[model samples]
Target: MPTSSPQPPPPADGLLSAARRNLREVAHGLTHASHPPTPLFADAPRPWQRLLPYGVVLALAATLIPVTINFLISEYGVPGGVAGALGVAQAAPLLMLAHRPLQAWWIVFPADIIGALVLLGYPVATYTVWPWTPPAIVGYLFLLLALGLRETRRTSIAVWLATGAAGVVLHVISPGRSNGSALLLPVLGAVVLVIAAAVRERGDAQRRLAEQETISEAERAQRTLLEERTRIARELHDVVAHHMSVITVQADSAPYRISGLSEEAVEEFGSIAASARESLAEMRRLLVVLRSDGTEGERAPQPGLDRLQQLVEATVRAGLPAELSLAADLGDVPQTVDLSAYRIVQEALANVVRHAPGARTRVSIASDGEHLTVVVANDRAERLGSPLEPTGTGHGLVGMRERVRLTGGTLDTGPLPDGGFRVAARLPLSPASPSSLEDL
Candidate 1:
């Protein structure tokens, strides 16, 4: 055999390319307006609760705006119009922080720079904080908190770094000014970012866990469905395959058993035997497909309505008082419907016994020429047990529904007003035709 050619080595990214990619990511994070706004009073039930955040923001604005404006005008000798504009710019973004934190930061960061520049030009008080005033610091910190809560860690970190960088630039332009803000804002913002990011991560983890649980539940249901279908197929094979085998054997022995048969008759018997054999072979293939690994075929014959009385008596002995009200003349039910009816009643009784331990139950089977109706209903449990018991895998109903569906029937199940449960299934008595099966 010829040796395979060696695969080409993957190309590596250069330092310049890596740096460019990182820069592009940072720029995109800063510019993109895709982050969802954190919900205000997300778990609150009342309208007032929903408006609480807005009320807080309004209170802060009412206090900070006039104070900032007065400080800018009185302490720095800035023009009144300029002072009002700066105050509004710094304070208004705080209101926007709940819904639009990054955009608010964009506004407040530049305003702080300009405020610092203007303050640099005028006389400064000895006790005044430089670059970022008290109100400005408070508003920016709130904005940082919102950004950390809603935005990605990468984006939040970029904004945090950018804020520090702006503070540093203001410090550089105004030498001999207090640079405490340069250190203070970043440190305080870092702490806020860390806490908010932790909360965000926890929320995301919880959502992911819930989603995973939902997915697992769906998968389990689907698996249970397939398993139930396979079980039905296996039981049907046992019922049908037996008849086919018998037909084949009888057809093969017909020529010998009967005396003075014509050549045509002998040939006809052979053909019948051949057809039956072919059917048996097909059923065997289907059974093979339907069986799971290491599952042995059920050798015993499947139950029918004849066994319903026994099942109920057993349930009655099992602590549930169940009465069987089977019709006197149900006539001849189709084999599939017979098996399905038996299984439906069996499962319903099993449920009552498992869930409502001491409940009174009624199992009724009726046939009206065209259909066979099975109803298994139970009154409320007298025992100290919950109807929604956690003992079973909850696949009993699934199996019953599957059986009813296969028989081209309808099933209804629900809780009664008396805190009891009921299961009713209507199955066709006449054998289903190929066309009807296809329709089903």
Candidate 2:
């Protein structure tokens, strides 16, 4: 293999091009009007809290303006008019510091340079701080603090470098002059800028965390809703699909069961049987889509009110003292109503066990021919034990509401006045035809 030729030395033009691009970027950042005003106490809850920042700024400006004007006029022997103008230029920017820091800096920086140049022409005390007066330094520090809070780190760094460069120029033009301010301003300004930038970074991190938490909550709720719907579909499929299958079988056997049936009667029964079978096939396909996975559905029959006694007995065994009172005559309850009532009671009891362990619980079922009502109430926990399971995903109430809605029913659930909980559901005995499932 041939040895690779040594890479040519980096071109001087490349370095110059990079420097020019950086300068243009810095100029754009300083001059651009795109930066929005940064609000003080943006998350303050009350009006008084929001107005507090303005009060502080007003006080600072009052003190700085008079002091600055006196210093420029008396110490530096400047004329009253010129000293007043420079003082106002330096102090007024503090008022704009909270909202428009960059603009304020633009005004104050030049004013400081001009004031220094004017004072240079006159005799000054050797002990006096030159270039940057005390009040002027304080005002610029405030401006830099706001700039760090509002602007990006890149912009902030550029601003700091510019300030240092200006200080350097002032020192060069007046060599041997007392240059304490030239050294002091840049060092102090750097500290203030660093602290303000750190605070801003922390606040941004917290806001992003809060937003992520909100998004996670929404996603969890959506997932719970889908799960509840899928479960409802599975139970109803077991109930309704069985009935459809029965209808198909009965229709097929009708002609054979009866004696001397006519041709027209036989043809009608055949049509009914065919329609029932087609409907069952379509329903199964719909169920497949509803299921979360391709696994087989529950093979066991869905529970109904007939299983309430066994469920209560199991609850009692599971550390919950419970009693059940069911009406003797429910008057041939519809299968949907029966299943929903059972599920509602089951979920309510489970909630009691999870949230209020060893609580006194009462489960009652009553019917008045038109509707069946289920109520599960528990007093405050008599004793707390390790829960039967870890805290649940808070979907119990959501499932109950969904079941009641499907059966044309109403649910009422809330904490009782005695620091207990109650879940009551009323399911219609004769619900309207389920048009919701017609597509299936």
Candidate 3:
């Protein structure tokens, strides 16, 4: 049998350790967790809103003091000085609560005890020690709410319990003219505490909710920006892929088209074509990631001048009658130029579809051997359907300008005098090297 290790001896200062643990628990229980304080009248409340609370409370305090003093002087026959002083003590603390709530709380109980004794001792004891008189009730209600707003629940509970104990002592020692109000005061105090707690909790919840909404809005803006960047990247990838495809085609057919003499020349051409094809393949994989829908199959090729007819036909089918005209020999144009030329028309036509619905559109492409020009013009809509809404935010023209710029091109777009819109782009037909295409 394996021998068990001896148990550690109890702490030498076991009693002291237990006492420390008990003190920690007591402190934790007494000190309630709290957040940054939110005053009922905030630090920077509007002038009117801030003044309203102070004005209302001061008015109540003013009214309560005079009425209580008059009652004491007329009915209880207390000295004028004593009545006035007691009334001031009871009501003055309420005024202090306007600025310093917790400090005001400390003053209320002492004022009440003094007022009750002055009334009971001199006059024939009309009411109990802590009677729920109108003035007393109003004062307690205000103090309870102010304390709940500015302090923690533990502090409020401690005050509430202490008030109840004081009332109990008053009832036992000198039960006076009426005990009914004595019972009512604590019940009403409990209700006021509940309402104050509810209000404070609601304020905390609203603050938390507002914070969450702000975070969500920021996240949404960031997501929109990322999506726009991805779209731009995908378009540039199309530009790169188009050039790479052309390089592959030209390299493969070089030896066959140019009557090459050396076998080494043929092998070199074959290597160039193979490398171009591999680069194109890698770019296509990246495109898949950019435009992923979880399908692992070949995507259709990027559109060029050859697909102009198909695009026009599709536009017609979508209810925007469009006409296409190729005025120059676009067949010999470089692939990047061909692609930019196509996208310019495509975006312009899309804009026509969106902004000038039911308008006749003309797409024209021309090349002067050095530059390729594309023009897409539309007339004002004769029959306006609801204009097509873009899937992305309003960056359509910005995207067009960017595409033209990347291809060493210029774009001009504006409204025409005929109440229509025109978009034109001229792309340089510079023949980029295969290595440059690979880098793109």
Candidate 4:
């Protein structure tokens, strides 16, 4: 689970920061590299790109250091060949940092040491530069990046100061070079790099924070949607159930308003009307269960084997040609098994009506001292050329399957060989260790 936590971003100059923000976007795209965005870096960066920043800085330092050495050749009055070789040696470490940043840790220290040694050598060289513009800031800057990038600040700072002292030594050794102001250049470079590092870390933090905000917004939206759906379900269930119950009671009382009726005959007719009203109420409540609000948890009736006959009556009224059969001699089936059997039959028949209208339907419910079975078979659909379209989303079948499975049962649904569709489900008889507590 990749968690989204708030993060502060890195900070640098406008251009560097702008570049880095763009880079962070690229980095985020890279983060899901297991599923990369673009074709190339979606995996990982090419070797060179990973090394470019370190490479460029080191290359620039190496280039500058030699120029400084060439400018100072005369002041030291050392042999030209010896000075030239010393300059190349001084620049080489900086160049190496480009290809191998890890090596820069070792290289940065030595470069600082050499520059320090050269500063110390100034007394021996007997040299002087009146205006102190020591370009040796290059060594300090390299150390800054080393420490900043790698979090090796203490060692970097110590090396920087040491080499800085050596650079001062070089001037003091030269004749008439009594002044040592060139030492400050390395100190300034160290400060700049420290500031730069802080800026970088700050920007990274900010980008992470922005991502957190995005995720939080999405979650709030999801919560709101769920709440709204629950409210709607509650309202629909309450309103429909209340109204249908009222209508059912009213219909049952309707025969009393009939005037010229024989007392016994009227009583019989009223009795029949009341039965019809009760069945109608049950049908209306079933529709409410299926299509109205999903909230009001206990408002929906729990239909099970007790309600099987009602389900059959409802189907007969729906214009389906149906024959329902049940076998006796049933053992004690579990409550969950009994409930699941009824639901499977109910959904199977509903699907037949929706997908195979005007078809002959057969329903069977049986318990044979072992498993309880419920089977619904219907003729092929005239409209679809089959009871189910090949491209069905399968949710109805899936729901039926789930209900059966949850109750320790198995269900199968498919086209029957004889130009029809059949759904059969078998649920377990009473649990071996029957539950004493009512609710599971």
Candidate 5:
């Protein structure tokens, strides 16, 4: 017996297999047509406008239902009851456009093909071809406009070009040309794109405006704080000037009041009085500038590293036991930088005196020609015999930060590991003045 070759599949089986494959392709397309992040149809300010799209989609589907039924019953000679059912089936996918737009497009392509093959008529007596029937135009135009709003510009443009190419191909192959309005589709798409662009630009402008308002508020607060600091400096100048004036007078008159005073003692008294008077004059000049409405003048000489020893001794006398260390030589630091450094040390020591009473404090200064680093640390407060807890304004750190910011410096302050507190700052050095090195 000869071996038999495998029999070819029958026509019915082959057709069924092809139909299943087409169904799978449609399902895959519909499932993969993603919903966009920013959807085109969304809630509108007017309640009716939000519902208008749904109403239009339903109306389009309804019109197509009657057209499908007439083609099935009158043209194809199907039973009236079955034709009604088939019409409902045909309208179902088009109605789905309101929810699954891309999926509905996928469904429409095959539905139109099947309708032409089965019904054997042209859009139920509409003059247009089965593919570009009135309902089909509505569906395609709506989908294109919606995609322009929902998807990104690149994706929308690609889809629009593809749709145009498909239309051109269909028009060339069809027996009759489509209606003349077919040429206006691109213009309609451009209009939709313009609307979407305007909406996006308006949203961006609003966001930028909100950010600018926040920045303006922050700058206003900073300006107010600096003004307050200047005012305090002006008021304190009077107290300092009075004490210096008293010291100058007392030192100048001391030699005459004492009998049998040595010549060296008299000379020392005169020198002490002169120095006090000079300091008093400088203080008065700086205060006048600070209080004046005038904009331009030379500022009084600011204290620098030369005054560090005096500041430390004064802090000690005020009952903050502070030790000072200079890790590197001060080499011609700028006057502003020098003044900022002195103020930082002064404020840190003051905080320790008020907040960390009886705490052993250490002050360290290091400079490497380009930058200066200052560190002040104090141990936790331990109640001593006589308590002198001065009330603080609580703006010491704020003032320190302002000073550091003015000098283009960075500051870090926090508690130490051993129940102590530390403040560290690094300031950029500026060009040294003529007397900067001499003062240091």
Candidate 6:
């Protein structure tokens, strides 16, 4: 094999090494970033709530450890400065942890463990001064209590057992054997252990109940969405079906009746056909909306006041020559009023086209102080042949009545004594009323 060329030396200033090191650091940061950050605790008055009580226990150890060490030294003549230093050192780690509540448990727990070992691990006879007994079982018992509040059951239990065992064993192993109150210390320490376990178990059950409530809330939201879809379907079936039926009847009769008419009359029928096509197109659009599953995004427009003109033109084209007269210059009418006016005019014209194809229609809109009136009156058809509007479901009239009432308006439709159909509506223009904002 041919000898391989020596690999190029690393960048002169160690650029390659620096780049590789930076890549490793970025990759390490990404890995850490993916983990949910430990949630920060809000700055509450009791930031050290969980650990301060534990600090009190450490303080007792500090006071007791040095005093017990000094007393032991004076009585038994065993001495050292180690007891005083270790007493203060015990609380140092705990106070540091108190500054960051979320990070305290890991650091404080281990410090408590090491502090206990440092004070108690020596032989009894070796350093019998304050190091031997002053801090006592009190410090360790309070540590278990704090652990119960801050940690889970299994972990707290382990720490509790270990600390309690150390307390009882060290009591028995010490050289000063008091034969008088043998069971006293063991019985009190055992009670502390039982209290810690109960507190830990209750915390676990409360957490489970909170999780169940969150799941129930999500299910209710999904059910409400399904019910809303069903309501939309029923509205489309009733509204579109009635409007389309009226347009079809007028369109079919126009061509036959006006055969001998002038060009203008023929053109009127063509316009009516176009209007019917537009109404059907609008109904199809409404059908698409009703069938859709509304997902989160921008909303679509509905047939409202803005579409009033289209409604009036369609009606006029339905073989009824109609004149539109505004009462108070209705221009910037509220959308709600626009929709109501459109439907009123639409239904009135459809009826005129069906009942009196030859009669000219006049639509008058006039505002009278606090109310507006809309009137559509047409002369009766010149002659009657086969029934043009059979199977009158009457739903068209009923729907118009409902829409008027919904808008706080009153409507009347009846045959004129002169043999024509006349429809009139009066709608309130109160400031609180939705249609009162109409510009016209």
- Top-lDDT candidate index: 2
Return the TM-score for candidate 1, rounded to 2 decimals: 0.87
- Displacement of residue 237 (Cα, Å) in model 1 is 1.5
As a TM-score, model 6 comes out at: 0.39
**lDDT for 266 (candidate 6):** 69
Cα TM-score per model? 0.87, 0.83, 0.63, 0.37, 0.39, 0.39
Candidate 2 structure quality by residue, lDDT tens digits, 1-440: 99999999998899899999989988888887346675677677898888887887788889899999998888888789989998998898788765777888899999888988887888868767888888899988888888888887878888899888888898998977756889898899999999998899898898899999999999999888878878887789888988999999999999989989999999999999999999999999988988777678788898899999999998888778999999999998888888888888888988998899988999999999988999999999988667776222226898898888888788999999999999999888996467733422
lDDT of each: 0.83, 0.85, 0.74, 0.59, 0.68, 0.53
Candidate 5 residue pairs that clash? none
Question: For candidate 5, lDDT tens digit of each residue in 1-440?
Answer: 99999998788788889988866764554446545432234545686776777787788787877886776666556578866765665565666555566656556645544443444433434443443444444555666555544444555565566556655655565536454334455566566657756776676597689889999989877766766467446544654665688999989999878889899999999999999999988987887778758754334644678889998988888877889998657787765667678878887887887777889999999988888999999998877454565433325787677666656778999999999999999987874345433321
Provide the lowest-lDDT 10-residue window in model 6. 34-43
lDDT of 3 by residue, 349-415 (tens): 8788777888999988888877888889999997766886533222567557656665667888889
Kindly report which residue stretches of model 1 are placed more than 4 angstroms away from their true locations once superposed.
1-13, 36-56, 70-80, 257-265, 386-394, 433-440
| TM-score, cand. 2 | 0.83
**What's the CA RMSD of model 1 in angstroms?**
4.2
Ranking by lDDT: 2, 1, 3, 5, 4, 6
**On a 0 to 100 scale, what is the lDDT of residue 371 in model 3?**
81
Model 5: what TM-score? 0.39
lDDT (10s digit) by residue, model 1, range 1-440: 99999998655667778888999998998888556675555556798887887887778778889999998887778899999999998887778765677888788888888888878877767777898887888888888888887777789999988888988787787757865977798899999999888988997898899899999999998898888877877888877987888999999999999999999999999999999999989888888888878988777898899998888887766667889999999998878888889988888877887788888999999989999999999999898845433222226999898888888789999999999999999998776656545522
**What's the C-alpha lDDT at position 341 in model 6?**
65
> How far is 262's C-alpha from truth in model 3 (Å)?
9.2
Per-residue lDDT, model 3, residue 391, is 30
